[model samples]
Target chain A: MAEFVQLLVSGLATGAIYALAAMGFTLLWQTSQTINFAQGEFVMLPAFIMLSAIKLFGLPLYAAFGVSLLVSALLLGFGFKRLLVDPMIRHGVLPLVIATIALGIFLKEGVKLVYGAEALPFPEALPQGIWRFASVSVTVNDIGVLLLVFAMVLALQGFLSRTTTGRAMQAVAQNPDTARILGIDVPRMITYTFLVNAALVSVAALLITPVYLAKFDNGESIGLIAFIAAIVGGFNQIRGALVGGLLIGVIDNLSGAYISAAYREAFPLLLLIAVILFRPQGLLGRAEERRV
Target chain B: MTRWLLPAAVLAVLIALPHGLKSYGIYLLSLWAVYAMAAMGLNLTLGYAGQVSLAQAAFLGIGAYVSALLTVNGVSFWLALPLAGLVCFAVGILLGFPALRVQHHYLAFVTLGFNALVFLVLRNEEWLTGGTYGVEGIPRPSLLGLPTQSPIGFYYLSLGFLVVLSFALYALLRSPWGRAFAALRENPTRAESLGVDIRAYTLLAFAIGSGVGGLAGAFYAPLVEFIDPTPFDLGTSLALLLMVVVGGSGYFAGPFLGAALVMLLPEWLRFSESLYLLLYALLVMVLMATCPSGLLGLWAQARERLSRRRPPPPVLETRT
Candidate 1:
């Protein structure tokens, strides 16, 4: 029972990051209607930037994280969408997706060229070690992850429901044409959406890099798994992404703990395939109507 | 006369390609053939069928491994090639069941998952694939009692097979079946209304596409003289897709042009590893932004412009 609880906690911790990434991915798709394959790369590159800043200037975590978020939001996310993504959107979804994939390789390779291939240890942010409750012990990082995610979710809900900018973004997401006619600057809103997405993922990277170590391909793995999480949660529903990400994270931990270690990688994918087979729309996703 | 002239000229160049080239040059040309053939296969599904499969590399890997194993055993390379394609085709069909259920992004994820699964299996399953070391000692094919041991002979052999299979693929794409595939792409509901079995045609597209990918893999194994899990990863799959896109997806010659550019450009760049990939990625974005239609599209645009600028030739009206 203790072991199970421990696994569950760790799973939830990992799932927290997955949820954050997935939510951002869902947001991008919701507003943009384009599947950005490099969404994961964004999650990855920002963390590296933060780490590089920390190393180069010896800044504190908060300062490094803040700077990284700004750079990613301004230069990578906003600038990238305005310059490249918006134009590609005119062509169709496929080209945009492929362009993102190329961007993914570019980002990953760019980091590789700079940092070399080895994984670097991120500076410790949270207090290390465990808190014991009977036979169950929980790490501070795990607790931090859960709290951070919850805070972000609550904040996102508030922003979406209560703020004018968030509401405008939501309106654009629902129908860009209608929103455009309503005199909302749709393109600007979309770029803002990307900005919000970059900020969310930057937070995720900050939380995750300490646990996993900063690596070039960190974004690729999480981005993909989180994508599965979003799909499982029902891609169209933002809330569903939260549920899907947690579920995947828990499943990942449980399988790694209880199942054959050698086959740990296959478990989430196999689970995803099974879930998709039964729930084609995902756990929280509404079924998309087949168009003629 | 003009249509035949282009093909004839292209063929003359291709046939003369291996001659006067060093062994490495021949190898690069052979790789071009592989990528071109594989990109053509991917185009059949993506361009014509409107399905986005991110698992082209997995099928290509499957083809390579199967052919590698078969040749390592006493089977002829000749026999192994089709057999490899057949295996990939069957796997592709099996994959179509899950694939056909989803739409858009979901479909992409499914193929991506398939790629991940295939890659993981290749890495972990040591007995059959020799794990990370990869399967080496893959034998070359002998055709018509000719010794294909030499680099030139092997290059020609691969080229000959590529030419034949590509023409066959072209014919297949031009057939009534191809028309059905096109109709599905244009309007699936309308195609279904016309009594086209959408599911069957989709599966058929997967089958044909994977078979071609497998054919490329078959050649890939012998040419590289080894096989590993790296080239079959998602990046390579994306590269294959990029090649088709960069070449112009829907056009027949697009994959060929795209493949040649992708495979040869890096070698021509003197193999500055980071520089080549960086340029390739930049090129993809620039191309996507400026000319989403790809190289073939660019050529068409140029030709259209030139013809427009030139004074119109006097038209002779033929009375039918």
Candidate 2:
């Protein structure tokens, strides 16, 4: 039971990061009808930027993180949507998909060229050490990540429900044509969606890099996990993405522990396949009406 | 006049080009042909049928491993090749069932998962696949008492298969089935309304495309004289997709040019060493942004401007 508790805590921490990434992914999908294949690389690149801000520019950790997030928000968020997605998206989803895949390769190769291919150690942000209770131990980092992500989710929920822009973004997601007819700026809302997504993923990158370490290729696995989590949780629901992420995190950890560790990566994918086969809309997703 | 002249000139070049080249050059050409075949298969599914699959590499890997395991154990390469294709066809059909339920992003996700699953199997099944050690020493097949052990000989063999497969695909594309695929891609609901069996065609699109990929994989195993999980990973799948997209997906000869560009451009750009991939990716991105229809699309546009005549139907449309 203690071991299970320990695994559960760690898994939730990992799941929190996945949840953050999934929310970003779902946000983009809902607003733009885009499936950003470069999402993993997007999340991965910000961590490297943060690292460089600290090491090369000699900035303090907090300042470096702020710079990194801002850069990512401006360049990856705005720059990506404007340059890559907007132009190709009008042609078809396939072109956009292919472009994003290329973007992923570009980001990965660019990072490799600039940052070097090695995994760099990330500075710990959370207070170090573990807390033991009733023969169960949990790291403060895990606790800190969970708390941060939970707060962020709540904040995002409040913003979406309460704010004019956030509600406009939600309106754009529901029906872009209808939203535009109602005087909402659909394109601007989409841009804001990308911006919010970039910020959320930036936070995920900061939180995750401490545990996973900053690696050039971390995006591939993390991206896949995020996609799975979003799909499992329900692509349309923000809360579903969170729940799905936590579920995947727990399942991945438990399976890695109780099942064969050799196939840890494959297990989540199998679950994804199962979810896709049986529940195409996802666990929390409603069945979409087929339109001609 | 231009049609006959173009193909004849191209054929003459293909035949004459290998003799002047060294062994490594011949190998690269053979690799191009092999990859072109796989890309062609991917084009049929993604470009023609409008189905997005990232599992072509998984099918290719399946074909390679199946053929390699059989041939290394004394089965004829001839028999092993078709058997490999058959296996992929069956698997593709099974995967197609899930595809029936999902569309666009969900379908791509499913296929991506399928690719990962296949990679895990290839990596972990060490007793069968030799794991990361890879299966090596795959002997080239004999063609009617002719030993294709030499690089030139294998190049000709690969070229021959490329020709045969191209002819077969051309015939298939001219048939009624091809029209169905085109219709399905253009608008599936409309096609279904017109009494086209979208479900069967969807499965066939996957099965035939994957079968061709498997056939290409059969060649790939002997061409490399080895098998491993590395080349069969998601990278190769993406690369194959790149070939189709870069060449002009719906165009019949798209994969041929795409495979060449994707395979050879890096070698030509080797002067940049590590920066070659970055350059290549940048080029692809620029092309996608400016003209998502690819090289053929640009060519078509150029032709349209010069002739000022009714142009062929474009690959790009507003159809979602």
Candidate 3:
């Protein structure tokens, strides 16, 4: 029972990271109608940037984190407007998707070239201590990550619900033509969406770096997990990403604990495939008419 | 007369050139032929059918393993090759069932997951696949009991296969089924409304594409004399797709030209080995941005403009 509790706690912590990433992915998809395959790369770039600032520039952890988030947001905003949104404005969804894929490949290979394809340990700033309740163990970092994730989600939800820009973004996502007709600049809203999504992903990177080592290929694995989470949670829903992420985390951890660790990654993917097969709209997703 | 003679002359030169080239050149040619075959298969699905399949590598791995196992067990290479294609065809059909029902992005995601799953299986199933170490010592094919061990001999064999395969593919493209595939790509709903069974055509595309991928892998096993997971990863699959796109997916000969340039250009520029991938990525991005229609499209446009500008040949009265 203690073991189960411990696994559950750890899984939720890990799931929170996935939730953050998936939230960013969902936000980007919602506003832009373009799924940025480079979304994971956005997470990775911030982590690397933070690491470099701390190690090379001798900056403090807080400063590094701020710098990384700012840079990531700017780069993502610029990249979306220039590389993806502009050329694709006239082309359609397919070209935009393909362009993002190309951008992802470029980002991944570009990172590999700079980082030399080696996993580097991130500097641990958080205290390393654990709380034991009977057989269940909880670490300080895990608790901190969980709290941070919750705070970020709440803030994002508030922003989306309360802010005019946020509502504009949502309106753009729902109907770009309508949004445009209503005097909203759809393109600029998309750029803001990209910036916001990247900022969120950057936060995820900074928080998760302490838990896992930073690496060039780190994004690939986490990106895949986030993708699975998005699908499982229903593609467009923010709340679904959170719920689905936590559920996936628990399921993945439980499976890993009870079964072989090698099969852990397979469980979520299998679940996703099953969900798509049975409930194509996802657990919480509303059914929409298929567009020809 | 000039155009016809030029192509025939070029073909004659190509057929004889391999005999005079060095062993390394012959090897490159053979590799080109094999890749071209694989790229052609990619073209059928992605270009013609408008399906995004990133599992080309998985099918290739299947073909390689099947061929290697069969050949090691003393099965004839000729028999093993067709068996590999047939097996991949079956797997492709199986994958197509779920694939046909999903959206394009969903299909892409599924194929990506499928590729990862295949890689995992290849890495874990040690008893059969030899796991991470992979299977080696695959035998080369024997034509009429004559062993094809030398590079020169292998080159000729591969060339013959390429010629035959290309001609067969060209012929297939001209058939009614090919027209149906094109119609499906142009408008799936419209095609369905016109009595074309969408699922069947999609399955057919998947089967044919996978079969060709498998065929490429089968021949590849003999040439390389080894099978491993590295070459059949998602990277290779994406590279194949990039080749198809960069070469102009709509053109018949685009994949062939694209495959050769992509495969050979890196080797020729081996000095910057580490930066080669970055360069390739940049090139792909630039090409995709500047010329979305691809190199062939650019050439076609240029040719159109040239033909339009040039004066038509003087009218000649022929009394034949």
Best by DockQ: 2
Q: Candidate 3 chain A, which ten residues in sequence have the lowest lDDT sum?
A: A89-98
- Winner of 1 and 2 under lDDT: 2
> lDDT by residue for model 1 over A1-292, one digit each (tens)?
9999989999998898889889988888888876778878888888888987888999899899999999989867788788778898767777787788888888888888888779998876667789999889999879988988998998998898799988898888778888999999998888888888889889888888888788888878887888888888877777888998898899888888898776787877886777777887778777652121
Off by over 4 Å in 1: A55-58, A289-292, B187-192, B271-273, B306-320
In Å, residue B132's CA in model 3 sits off its true spot by 0.9
Per-residue CA lDDT of model 2 for A1-292, tens digit only, reads 9999999999999998999999999999888878888889988999999999998989988898899889998988999999888887778777787788788888999999888998999988778899999799999999999999999999999999899998998888878888999999999999998999989989988888988899889999888899899988888889989998999999999999999898988888988889889988888888762221
TM-score computed on alpha carbons, candidate 3 = 0.92
Of candidates 3 and 2, the better by DockQ: 2
Runs in model 3 deviating more than 4 A are A92-99, A112-115, A125-127, A289-292, B1-14, B307-320
Q: Write model 2 residue lDDT over B214-319, tens digit each, in one string.
A: 9999999999998889999988998898899889888888899999999998998899999988888888888888778878878888888888876565545423
Tens-digit per-residue lDDT, A1-292, candidate 3: 9889888998998899888888888877777666666667777888889988988999998899888888887787666567656776454444455566677767777888888788888876556789988778898878887888899889888888799988888788778888999999888888887788878888888777766778877777777788778878888788878887888889999999998776677788778877776776667876562222
The local lDDT score (0 to 100) that residue B103 gets in candidate 1 is 54
Q: Which candidate's lDDT is highest?
A: 2
What is each predicted model's overall lDDT from 0 to 1? 0.82, 0.88, 0.78
DockQ of candidate 1 compared with the true complex: 0.46
What is the TM-score of each candidate's chain B when compared with the real chain B? 0.91, 0.96, 0.90
Question: Interface RMSD (Å), each candidate?
Answer: 10.0, 2.1, 12.0
TM-scores for all predictions: 0.93, 0.97, 0.92
